[model samples]
Target: MPMSITLPGPAPWGFRITGGRDFGKPITVSKVTEQGKAAMGDLRPGDIIVTINGESAAEMLNVEAQNKIKQSPGQLRLQVERWVLMGHLCNVNLVIPNRPLAPQNCRCLHPKPIPLHPNPSLAPRPRRCSHPCSSHPAPPPIPGALMLPSPPGPVR
Candidate 1:
């Protein structure tokens, strides 16, 4: 089963890297706050975001392309981008929200337990030996429960 993680739930505020139009010129900005935090800042509506903290939006998007490489849901990371300053591209960084988590396979699936039974015959038996049937040989006779000895050897 897949589990959906709610936004603004456990992760920090979202950060962004913006680029494109700026005073009829192209530029970028690596970081910006979400709507909630943006209201408390001096951010303008026309600002371009580029990244948050130290990671670029394109890099983050690449990381999210594969589910196995994505960070745990709600984890925060740094963003990075360029911004127009004094008619020059200025790189920046900001903290941002991590992508939400979709449903994942549950690890709790297991086989049902089997009930036990009472009594000797009803219970499990000892496993048989795995020796092959083609190796049968004559059985040796026991001498008073002790092994027989070899004949005496020649003197030196």
Candidate 2:
């Protein structure tokens, strides 16, 4: 069964959303306020928003979707994909997983590698091959089977 929520205008939907790779991907529900319209409407974290006010949310940017929800004065319709768990007695309950946090900034924590120059002369030199076969001429091919090139040497 689908849920339709009617919320007051000019106010937020009371949920946090994270945008996808592009506007084409469905935005995920990152968090839902405890006493907000979203919680009252049964919106949960991890729900993949499908549509808003009959418009396809798959192609909507996070701000666009938020704008659409806010534009509606009296009512807002949201279609989302949620997970349901089935019980032994045939009862079903919506599962709200823990909200995912924004990715940590680790670039500053890690040591930066030496930057290479754009000029070819300043770039790192090609490693010299130590294998005898790499520098030596191929031996005479055997008659019976086709010969395939040897695989590259293993990494250090």
Q: Count residue pairs with overlapping backbones in model 1.
A: 22
TM-score, each model?
A: 0.20, 0.47
Model 2 TM-score?
Answer: 0.47
Residue 149 lDDT in model 2?
17
| Residue-by-residue lDDT tens digits, candidate 1, 1-156 | 111112232333343333333233222223446574332332323333333333333433322322211342543332211111110011212111111112123222111111111232442322222233212111222222211111122100
Can you give the lDDT of residue 2 in candidate 2?
A: 31
* Candidate 2 collision pairs: none
lDDT of 2 by residue, 132-151 (tens): 32321122222332112111
Q: Model 2's lDDT to the true fold?
A: 0.48
CA lDDT of every candidate? 0.25, 0.48
lDDT score of residue 24 within candidate 1: 31
What local lDDT does model 2 show for residue 42?
71
Lowest lDDT block of 10, candidate 2: 86-95
RMSD of every prediction: 32.8, 22.9
TM-score of 1: 0.20
